[model samples]
Target: MMLSVFILMTVLSLMMKIDNSISANCYTCNPCPTPFSPSSYLVRNKTGCRYCAKIRPDGYPIVVRDCTDTCEFSTWSYMFSKYSYNCCTGNFCNKSQTNYPTHQMVILLLFTIYLFVNKTSTKI
Candidate 1:
């Protein structure tokens, strides 16, 4: 029972740590302009925790933070249609007007650790 309690506490702590790491704000706009300054807002996508900035080959840019449901997850690439997409996780990550690919590896690492701890706690 004590071991279970310890495991549960550890899991809870890890989850709290992960939850606090994400920024509460993100940039959202349609056809975000060059020399852009995007307005920030609290993220509402819940599971759409990723931030995306897509620049059409024509130079029109879209900045938004949403889950995979809203924006299809893809690696950095320019489709034949001449559209380039970049995504990163973190508040305001999409604020950059330049479509440089951003990687949220730290967030992924922490999330993985949280999941592992949670699973171990359940077994306890």
Candidate 2:
């Protein structure tokens, strides 16, 4: 019984450690510069926007002659089409991101139970 308890605690501690490490590396938004053009509408793209602007060589008196919406933002929902759009815009701790850790916790819980049962039923 004591051995089983020890093993269970050890496994739980290890799982918590793993969870902390994984969450530490989780993705977070960084303040990125706006890459959109005043003349053109912005659209989502893989890397960034791709538009043509006609500005003077001296960079004065800019004009919005033509524009296109070709700007893209870094969002988990955009990256993972399976996830809902709200996953990225709202809370950071959503199902999409918690799936992995939740799965790990479930597996660890099952394993711990199994170990406890096996240890108790074993005959010396």
Candidate 3:
């Protein structure tokens, strides 16, 4: 019974260590860049930084990726800039994506129907 208990404790410790493993690399370049992003540059992530950061401003062509000592997940807006700031503990997590929500298309369809109905009723 004592031997079994020791083996169980050893297995649990190994499992805990595996769970604590963190990605140790970060990309120091913007994952995605646009015309409005003055310093947009992208490069593959290598072993780097304590934390990784990506920032994008909504409806504005702004993008940033960086290595930071400390970071947290957050978002904010100022002036003409609506910013989404994301800070992650692992460095290999920054990747560029171009996407649009399907819900926006649904909203557009509804708007078009409303306009058509309003115009037809006015004429009648």
Q: Which candidate should be chosen as best, given lDDT against the real structure? A: 3
TM-score of each model, paired residue for residue: 0.37, 0.29, 0.39
Please write out the lDDT profile of model 3 over residues 1-124, one tens digit for every residue.
Answer: 4565466557656654543355446555544544324243455555646656667767756566666655544322332255676655543554434223223345556656766786799799
For candidate 1, lDDT tens digit of each residue in 7-122? 75687677556644554344544434445654333323233353344444445344333322234434323333445555555555565655443333444565568778988998
**Candidate 1, pairs of clashing residues:** 48-67
Please give the ranking of all candidate structures by TM-score, highest first, separated by commas. Answer: 3, 1, 2
Residue 62 CA displacement from its true place in model 2, Å: 34
**Candidate 2 per-residue lDDT over residues 9-95, each given as its tens digit:** 787888665553432111122211133222223321121112211111123322111111222223332333332222111112211
What lDDT does each candidate get?
0.48, 0.35, 0.53
**Highest-scoring model, TM-score:** 3
Candidate 2 clashes between residue pairs 3 or more apart in a chain or in different chains: 40-67, 40-68, 41-68, 41-69, 42-69, 42-70, 43-69, 43-70, 43-71
- Prediction 3 TM-score vs. true: 0.39
What stretches of model 3 exceed 4 Å from their correct place? Answer: 1-23, 34-41, 44-46, 72-82, 96-124
Q: Put the candidates in lDDT order, highest first.
A: 3, 1, 2
Ranking 1 against 2 by lDDT, winner? 1
